[model samples]
Target: MVRSKKTEDDHIKVAKDLLLASILPNVEFDGWSSGAFEQAVIDSGVDISLVHQIAPRGAIDLAVAFHKKGDELMMHGYKQENFTELKYSEKVMQLIKLRIQASNTHKGAVRKGMSLFALPQNINEGGQLIWKTSDKIWNTLGDKSTDSNWYTKRTTLSAVYSATVLFWLCDDSDEAIDTWNFLNRRIRNVMEIEKAKAKIKKTSFGQSVFSFFDLLQKPSNEHKSGFPGYKG
Candidate 1:
C-alpha cells in the first residue's frame, strides 16, 4: 500500500524517535553513522532500508533529530510556564535553562556527538546545528525578527550555548550549580548591554547617531532583531 505524505512523515518521525533512543546509549561507540542507525532500526523492529528513504545524511541526520528532540522537550516546558508574563530577560534565561535541563537525559550522547562535530570536516555542520538550535529557541519565544538582528541574536546565543554546553559536559560542581550561575552571569551581561543601548538611544546625540546608523543599516531590518525581538 502506498503511504500518504503525512503518513510518510509520521513513519519517519516514529523511526527517528526509536533511532534516538537506541543510539543514545551507543552513539559513543558507533559515532552516529549509518551502521549505528541500522542497528537502531533493527532495535526498533523496523526495516533498516527505511533509514535511506527517511534520513539519508546518516550520522548528521540522526544528530539533528536528537537535537530537535531536546528542542521539543524544551518547548513543552516553555509552553507550560507563564512565559508570556515573564520579563524578556527572564524568559530568555528560562529558555536556556530549559534546553540544558532537557539535555540531561542524553548528555552523554550529546557529549560524544560534540566531539564528532569538532572534527575539521564536520565543523561546518556543527555551526549550523547551533544556529538551528537558536532558531528553535527564538521560534518558541515567538521571535519574528527578519534583519541583521536576526543573524546577530542567533550568532550570539550560539556562542553562549556552545560555551555553556562544553562547561556543562565537564561540570563537576554539585548538580551543575556552577553552570546555572554561569548562565545567569552571561544573561545578566547581555541584559546590561541592552539597557545601556536603550539608554543611549534615548539621548539627543544618541538619537542622531542612531539615526545615521539606521541610515546605514539594512533597510529590511526595520524591526529590532535581537533576543526579546522588540519591534521598532
Candidate 2:
C-alpha cells in the first residue's frame, strides 16, 4: 500500500492545485472525482515500496491512501452508523459536555462570519442529525426517572443543538452569536422539562408506596358474614 515518492508528491500537488483551488472550495468532493488523481499516480509508475514508506504529502494523499485502504478519513458520513455506542457514564458525560461547548463556540463563530459556500446535501439531512442530537441528549440524562417535564426539556435541548449545528455549517456572518443565543434558549427549555419530570417522579413514587398499603385492606363485612354462613 505504500506509494512511491513521486506518487505521494503528485497527490499533494493535485490536492493543493486542483481540489483546494479557489474554484472548488464550496464544491462537494466525493470518491468518484478522485479517480483523476489516481490515474495520475498510475501514470507516474513510481516504484511501490513499503506501505508505510509512502510519504504522506498531505490531506490529498491521505485521502487517496484511505480510499485505497478503505480507512475512514473523518468521523462523518454513514460510517458513524457502525460507530460503537458510547457508555452513558461519567466519561461519556464529559465527552458530550465537551462537544456541547465546542458546538456552542463554533455556532457563535459561524454566525459572526458567514461562509460563501454550501455544504453537501448529504451532510444537511435533518433526520439523521436530529436523531444524533437526541441520542446524545438521552445518553446525557439516561434512565434518571424523569417525568413529562423532563421529556419536554430533553426535546427542547436536542432541537436547539441540532438547529444550531445546522445553521453554523452554512452561516456566513463574521460572528455567529445568533446561533449561540438560539442554543441557550433551547438548553433552558430542556432544563425546565428535567425539573418537571423530577417532581412528577417523586409524586409517583410516593403514591406507589401508599397504594401498596391500601391493597392490604380486609374484605367488606358483608362478604365475611356470608362466608361464615356457608362454612356452617
Candidate 3:
C-alpha cells in the first residue's frame, strides 16, 4: 500500500499530539521544550524536521495547539451528551466542566502550558486560544446570534472559562467542587446580564446601541486562526 500524504493541518495535529504526549509524561522536568518535541518525533516515528515547519514558535505553538485540542475534545464530548433533559444553563455548565475534566489527567502539562501562555508576548496567542475555544463552544451549543450579543456572549464566556481554569489549577480539594461552584456562579452572572440585555434591546435606546454594535461586528465568520500551527 502507498502512504498517503499528510496535509498541513494533519501535520500540525500529528506533530502537536505526539509532542504533547511526549511532553506530558516528562513535562515537569523538561516542560514544553524543543527537547520534548524532539523526543516526540523519535517516540512517534514521524519526521523530526517537520516540527519546525509545523510549529516555528516551538513550545508556544504546541501550547496553543494543546488548548485547541481541548476544544476539539470538548466538541466531541458535547455531541455525545443527552441534551434533551438538560436545561440550557446546565448544558453550558456541563460543556465547560467536561472540557476541564477530560484534561484533568494532564494537570501538570496544563500547568506548564498556562505558565507559558502567561509570557508577555504570548498574550495575544492566549486570547486567541480562549476566543477559539469560546467560539467553538457556542457553535457546539447551537448559538445563532449574528449581533452584538454574539460578541458579548463569547467575551463573557472567555472570562468565565479562563477564570475557572485558573481556579481549577489551585484547588486540590475533593474533586475541585470549589471550582465548579465558582464556574456556576460566573455563568449565572453572565446569564443574568444577558437576560437584562435581552429586555433592554426591545427599547429604542437599546436598539440604537445594538445598531452601533452591529457596525462593530466582524465582517467575516472566520475568526483569526493565529495559532502558529494553523494554516487556514
Candidate 4:
C-alpha cells in the first residue's frame, strides 16, 4: 500500500524527534557538531541515509528544530497561565521568562546552539530566530498594531529577549533572581523609550516629523507583495 504524503511527513517528523532526543546529550559535549549528529544517528538507530534526507544541513537543522521546539513549548505554557490581571509589561516579562525556562533542562544544548548560531554564516539565521521569538510573544499577547509600531515593538522586544537570554546564561544567582531583575530593568528601559516616544508625539514638531515618517512607512500587511524597499 502506498503511503499518503501526510504519512510520509509524519514519519519524517518522528525520525527528527528521535534524532533530536538522541542529540541532546551529545550536543552538551559536541556542541551540535557533525560528530554529535553522527552519534545521534547511531543512538537513534535511524538509518544514516534517512537522517541525511531529513536534516539536509546536518546538525544545523536539528539546532533550528530545537529552537523551534522551545518556542512551541513556551506557547503551550503561555496558554496554561492566567495573565488577565497582569499589566502588559509584566505579561511581556513573564513570556520571556517562560521561554527561557522552557529550555532550562537543556541549557547545555542552548549554550551550544548559541555558539553555533553566532558564527558569521549563522548570524542572520540566529537574528531571524530572535525576531521570530519576539514576534510570537507580541502576537500571543494580542498586539494588533499593523503600522511602524508593529516593527518597533518587535525590534525592542527582540533586544530585550536576547539580552535577557545572555544574562540568564551567566546568572548564578539563587533561583536566577538576578536574571529576572536584569530582565525587569531591560523591560523598564523599553517602557521608558515608549513613554518618551509618546511624549514626543504629543509635541507639534514631533507630530510633524512622525507624520512625515509615517508617509514613508508601510503597514505590515503591505509587505506580502514582496516590495523591494519596504523594510519590515
Where model 3 places Cα greater than 4 Å from the true spot, the runs are 1-15, 38-45, 202-208, 222-232
Off by over 4 Å in 2: 1-126, 133-157, 166-174, 205-232
* Root-mean-square deviation of every model: 5.7, 19.3, 3.4, 3.8
What is the model-wide C-alpha lDDT for candidate 4? 0.86
Q: How would you encode candidate 4's per-residue C-alpha lDDT over 1-232 as one tens digit per residue?
A: 9975678778888998999999999899889999999889899998887888878889999998898888999999999999999999999999999999999889899999999999999888787788888878988998977667777888889889988999988888998999999999999999999999999999999999888666644345555334321223
Candidate 4 segments whose C-alpha is farther than 4 A from its true place: 1-6, 216-232
Could you give me the TM-score of model 2 versus the true structure?
0.33
After TM-score superposition, the amount by which residue 148's alpha carbon in candidate 1 deviates from its true location, in angstroms, is 2.9
Candidate with better lDDT, 1 vs 3:
3
In Å, residue 214's CA in model 3 sits off its true spot by 3.5
| Model 1 bad stretches (over 4 Å) | 1-6, 33-35, 199-232
Greater lDDT among 2 and 3 belongs to 3
187-223 in candidate 2: lDDT tens per residue? 5565576576557557968567544544443334465
Ranking by TM-score: 4, 3, 1, 2
Query: Native-vs-model 2 lDDT?
Result: 0.39
Write one digit per residue (lDDT tens) for candidate 1, span 25-128: 77867777767766776777756677776567776778877777787888888878887678877787788888888988677778878977888987876777
Q: What is the Cα-based lDDT of residue 56 in candidate 3?
A: 76
Roughly what TM-score does model 3 have, to 2 decimal places?
0.83
